[model samples]
Target: MAKNTYKQDEILEEPFDIRHLLRASSYIKKYQKRMIIAILLSSLGGAFGYIAPMITQHALDVAIPDKNFRLLFSLVIALLALYTGSIIFVTIRSKIMVEVSQNIIYDIRKDLFEHLQKLPFQYYDDRPHGKILIRVVNYVNSVSDMLSNGLINIVLESFNLLFIVIFMFLVDVQLALVVLCGVPILTVFMIWIKNKQRKAWQAVSNKNSNLNAYLQENIVGARITQIFAREDENAQIFQDLSQDCRRTWNTAVRYSNLVWPGIDAISVCVRAAIFLFGLVIFGEGNKSLGTIVAISSYASFFWQPIMNLGNIFNNFINNIAYLERIFETMDEPVTVSDKENAKEMPTIRGEVTFDHVAFSYDETKKILKDVSFTVKPGESVALVGPTGAGKSTIVNLISRFYNVDSGRVLIDGQDISEVTIHSLRSQMGIMMQDSFIFSGTIGDNIRYGKLTASEDEIRKASRIVCADDFISRMPEGYDTEVRERGSMLSQGQKQLISFARTLLSDPSILILDEATSSIDVQTEKALQTGLNAMLQGRTSFIIAHRLSTIRGCDRIMYIDDGGIMETGSHEELMAKKGYYYKLYTAQLEEVHKTA
Candidate 1:
């Protein structure tokens, strides 16, 4: 396969903003009482802490000197009480934060997974599976942690800062002015660094998504890559992508790292200024030694926590950045939705028709143009074409994976859009080229088509498709586990399993796209022969390269360049000597030569 290219990449990064955080507050607010209590306790601790040093300073400078041993003892007790209370508050706060984070994560995970289930197949087609998985992991996890810490830090720290300032001003008005003036400047720098760090983190996230997508695709398609000897090329591409991802992550960490140090340096400078000025004021007797000691202690204390706050704010902003990504996905309105009063179609007859249909993946490029076809009830039709001739697109439309741009698709004389998805899809059985064998027993895999299918029904369906021959040969038979996509089975056996799975549905409409492409000639013949029993009285669309298998089909449609160029029985098409005749003759002569 060739590497795919797109004209432009999406700008995945958004400005770090709290509007999304506010929107998701309800999810976190469920633990509001606990969070508030945690913050309240932390505030009480911080308040006691700020007052302890002041009390100690007064006792040291005056109480002890005046032979007031009782006052000194009281101040020491106050310091002990402050530390003891803070320890208790810290323990409770940590526990509550953990619960809040986990709870929020649970809600986010559920919301995202459910939303994915409700999204249309077209959404998955346009986006890579790995990219989706990355969002679920990186963005969602980020939001979960951020919501908890961001809420608590803002509340506790704000209270702590307020208490420190209030008492500092009471001790000496001028010293408070100096610290307040510099505080804004430090805040400005912290916010600036946080914004930049947020952008870098988002960049790493986007690149990591692409890296994950590449790794997933390469792993799942490793066999094909090895067969084509493209392993070396893929390895090199992955190596380059991995390095790019590393560089992006390192850069994000570097900028975020700068935030804390920058705040610390500003704090250190402010503390030094307060102390030098305080010494001069004390010598002038404008302030007492106890007042100077208290003022210096408060200013020094201010720097470390508020400076460490540069980190909390950075995380706060980083969390908000993740918030934007989550909100972006969650905020997308379901463009394709069932009607408000749509009724489930009961037991459709599979009368599928496209009335002069035209369609496109996007506005500018038309992939299917003015095409019309009908699959009558209980009829089998084979569609043949070169790649990009719109065969799969036609089948997708029948499945209503994408609605037509300017035409109507009627199912059993009813517009499909009027019917519910469950009823419409339940009637159709699709065996796609890349089969999905979920992790479960053989019986479970077969029963995926109809959840309510019993073991006997599943076995009977497999027996109809001749899969019982090998299935019974297995150690545990139908109960055997098929881990990691039935790797234990060969290509032909997997195809047989797919056939059996589709048949268990007993659908009114059936579609097989390159269904036998992976099987051998003998097995393909047997599979098709087995299919004959299941095909009767069902509308079917079969797209195959082996022209011989569809000889019994009522009509063979030769699709070319988004339109049907010819349609007739195998013998009728062979007589025409057109595109269908050439396609048929090429395969026929090759088989004869092989014989």
Candidate 2:
């Protein structure tokens, strides 16, 4: 798979799709009752608005000219009452839709996050995390109003436009036809800009995603940027991304801004035409003053909804871009999920076997090819290999982080692929090259391995990994707060804490890849006593560049060229004087030269 990058936009091949809205209806369906009530309230408020013009016509034609002060005062009160009712209904509808919109956003963000968790490492590997973050947070937020209030407004405005037309025709047929002319003019203008507007908004979304991806990457790698004196270059890159975002946004807004003004201009022209036809062309004798006034008001009412509909449609076009991105993430395939009939793996006895396993990250090259290996329960095996020679891939396979391309991995004679991933992985402890520490107390970080673990368990695990020494020397001991990535701790301390975290899980099989690379020789020597004690009666795979560390293991496998080059007790391999002997002697010579 091609890696997704911040330098380019994600290609979306689908054109403006209504199916996006149809699929979104599932989320709306959960709040259908509230949406219906809100719609009805909005329509009711609009109905009140519709009656105001007729009341004004009545006041002018009947009450005011006839010198009936009482009737005039009553019409004033009625209009006030209608306005107040409209305000009340609109307020209530706004509140309901706000709640419904928030709920929909919550549901979408939650589902997106849950799906993201199930995606394989390759999914994350192929894309910048910032792009994923923007979709889950920013893109999901942008669609809330469109999904809720915008949907309701679409219905309300359509009805408002329909009723305005009916009321105009009833007032004066000729004037009504004049007002109707504006509809086609407005429709043509909207159609002309529709595709352009949609595409522009889609560009805006892509640029925003790119900007977000770049921003997040810069923030995370700020330290490295400073170390390499690349701040000026990075800032220039950020400025370019920001400029692209602004450019796309301005283009989208320019298209959107054209919508209302076009409608308003058509509206004004249509109203002027109504007066011209009613008073002069059609003759004032045929059309009464009251009829002229009512129809003119209806003309305003007519285009108001059209203008509103244009704005709503504009919002829909903009938000639909974000909506598609959100749905795309939700629809990402979970390549490492449990099989349909997969059962919970029975408690692992730590017997791990790879039967002719062949694997690759992508199709172009294979990482492991037709390899076979087995480690008996309670054996401590060390894997030593040159970098990128499938050392980490071997341990990752045991955890089923990626399914093998051609063969099976079995645990105690049962195929791991036939069991639940959770069950298989839950029984294994894996400590990788990077030790990530969340922002929390040291105890909280360790307790992540066993959520129900007590303070004693945390301390015990820390002691086992020799993390307790530095932790005890701290001012707050176990309660000392650590920032994200444990910036306050040294690399060795971070590794020690991570080691404790893995040890706290009490996994049946423990795999540590370059686990002690950061620690000094003295600390590594000190850690070995507890490490040896912890390895008793458990199956463990240790990968370390320091060949001195694996000499005590029951067996050592020198892995290279997509298969194990040699396997034996350290002394036996040393006597054989093959690949393992040469590599070990080379490392010793380099160390003595450095000393």
Number of the top TM-score candidate: 2
Q: Write model 2 residue lDDT over 171-277, tens digit each, in one string.
A: 77878998887777788888787767877877887888888889988888988999999989999999999999899999988988887777778878987887789
TM-scores, each model vs. reference? 0.89, 0.95
Q: After superposition, how far is residue 409 of candidate 2 from its true place, in Å?
A: 1.2
lDDT (10s digit) by residue, model 1, range 348-415: 78788998889888777788889988888989999997888889889888888877888888888888
Clash count for each candidate, listed in order shown = 0, 0
Off by over 4 Å in 1: 1-13, 16-19, 62-78, 171-175, 184-199, 284-290, 333-335
Residue 503, candidate 2: Cα error in Å is 1.2
